[model samples]
Target: MNAYGINPDPSEITEITPAVDGVESIPLPLYGYNVSAGFPSPADDFIEEYLDLNQLLVKHREATFFVRVSGCSMTGAGIYSGDILIVDRSLDPAHGKIVIAVVSGELTVKRLVMRNGRAILRSENPNYPDIPAGDELRVWGVVTSVIHKV
Candidate 1:
C-alpha cells in the first residue's frame, strides 16, 4: 500500500521468517508499577522482577514465527511497513484477529473476519478491498505481537 493507505500493489510482498530457537535469554529489569501517561507520578526505584521478552510474548515456542510487513495495508491497525509481526500457528483464526495468511501463494498480513460461514481477509485500511477466502486461502498463523522501533 502507498502512503495514502490505499491502492495495494500486487508486486509488494510480505516476508516470513521462522523464529530461531536456542538463543540465550537476556533478562531485563522490570518495574512493578505501571507508569502514568497523563500525569506526573512518583516512580518506583526498585526492580520488581526480571523480564524476558520471548517468555512474555511467545505462548507457543515451536509454533511461532516472524513476518516482516512490506506495506501499509494494515496501517489503521498501527502496523506499518518494516514492522516485525510475531505470528503463532497454534492460535485459532478467530474473528477479528490479524493473521498471516497465504492467498494465491502469496503471504499477506490482514485481519480475519468470519461472516455467515464465510471468511474474508480484511485490510485495516478502508481504501483496500476485502479478500474473500477461497480454495487458495490458507491461514498460516494468528499475529500475536508487533515489534516496532520507536
Candidate 2:
C-alpha cells in the first residue's frame, strides 16, 4: 500500500547519477516534472550555482545501493511507500536497527528485535504482524537513509 496514496509504476525507480568523481551511479527518482507544461527556467547563474557539486555536504561517493519502498508497513517510521532507501551493506546490522532482510526467499524491511533466544522482525505499523525467525532469514543490510519526494 502507498502511504502517500500515490501508486507510481515500478519502472519509475530508475537511478540518477550524482555529478561527483568516483561515485558509483545509484538510482534516484526523476525530480523534474511539468517542464513541458511551460515551467519557467531559473536564471542561468542560479541553476549553475545550485548544480555545482562542490557546494554539497554529502558526496555521492558515500552511497552504496539504493532500494525503493513499496508498502505502508514502515510508514510510522517515516519510511513511506515510494521512498528510496540508501543501504550500506558494509555496515553491520545490530539490534534495534532498521534493516532489510530476506526470509524464505522474500525481501522485507523491519526493525530487528532480539529477545531471549529468538529474533522478531517488528514492523513500524502495528497493523502488520511481527515476523518470527521460523523461516530461513538472512540480514541483507542496514538502512542508512530514506530519501523521499517532497
Candidate 3:
C-alpha cells in the first residue's frame, strides 16, 4: 500500500513477464513533501521514510507476475502498450476489476464484469468489442498496479 496515499500520474508497479522474477529490496529516501509542478517551495531536509518500491507494489510476492501490455484495449484506463502490469494470482477476480484472462488460447487484459450470471471481458477502448468469457475463460490473475513510464 502507498504510505502517504499519494497517487502518481499513472501508478506504481512492476514485473517482467515470460520469466518469473523477484523485485529487489531497494529502499530509497522518500521526502514527506509533495513535489510541486508549478511554483517551487522550501525543501524539507528530513527524510520521512525509506520506501521500498518492491514491497509497496507487490502484495503477494510468490503469486504475483509482471505482464507487459501488448495493445491499446485498456488505454482509457491509463494502461498502454509496453507498460508493465503487476498481477496477483492470490487475489480473487471481482467485478469492475482489471484482469488477465486467457481467451481463445490468447492472453488479453480487460476489465471483468458480471452481467446476469454471465462474465464479460470489457475493453476500455471503444474500438475493441466486449468478449464474452465463458468456457474458455481462465483468469491468470487480477491487476494490482500499473507501471507506466514517462
Candidate 4:
C-alpha cells in the first residue's frame, strides 16, 4: 500500500512540468523573530531580510523537482492532498524515507521499508495495505520536504 493506504490508479497521477517562462525566482522577507504559536511576543516586529526559498529548499537544482500530492494516503506522514512535495533524485532512497516511485508504470509516493529482505511500500495511513516492491518497481526520488499552505 502506498502512503494513502491504497493503490493509486495510473490515471490519478499527474506530472508537473517546470515553469519555463521568464519567471526566475521568488524571494520573500524572512522575519528575525521567531513567531510563537502560543502567546504573543514583542519580537514579531523584526525583519531579517529577503530570503530566497530556492536556496533553502533546493540543495541540488538539477535533481530537484516539485510534485503536487493528489491523495490522502500520506496524511499520516503529514503529507496531505494539495501539498507540494520537494523530491530529490540525487538522494539515496534509504529505508524509512519517503520516496516517489513507479510501480508497473504507475507513479506513487510512499515510505520505503524493508521486510524479510524484500522492499515494501508502506502507506502512512492505517486504512491502506502494504505493497510489495516487485520487479517492476523503480525508485524515482526521495522526498525531502512537503509544502502546505494554511
- lDDT for each residue of candidate 4 in 1-150, tens digit (9 for 90 to 100): 443345553322365544233546888867777666753453536657878777788888778888887777778899887788888889999889999988777778899998878889888887767778777788999989888999
Residue 44 of model 1 has an lDDT of: 55
**TM-score of model 1 vs. true structure:** 0.84
- Please give the TM-score that candidate 3 achieves against the real structure: 0.81
What's the lDDT for all of these models? 0.80, 0.64, 0.74, 0.77
Q: Give the total clashing residue pairs for model 4.
A: 8
For 1-150, candidate 2 gives per-residue lDDT tens digits of: 232233322222233233346554444333344467665555443232223223232333454467787877887889887887776666788889988777665567888889897777778887776777665778777777787898
- Give lDDT tens digits, candidate 1, residues 1-150: 432244543423467677778978889878767676653343556568889998988888889988788877888999888888999999989999998878766788889999999998898887778888788788989999999987
- The positional error of residue 45 in candidate 4, measured at the CA in angstroms, is 6.6
lDDT of 3: 0.74
RMSD of candidates 1 onward, in order: 4.6, 9.6, 9.9, 4.1
Lowest summed lDDT window (length 10), candidate 2: 3-12
How well does each candidate superpose onto the true structure, as a TM-score? 0.84, 0.61, 0.81, 0.81
Candidate 2 Cα misplacement greater than 4 A, ranges: 1-21, 24-63
Candidate 3 stretches greater than 4 Å from native: 1-23, 38-46
Of 2 and 3, the candidate ahead on TM-score is 3
For TM-score, the strongest prediction is 1
Candidate 2 vs. true structure, TM-score: 0.61
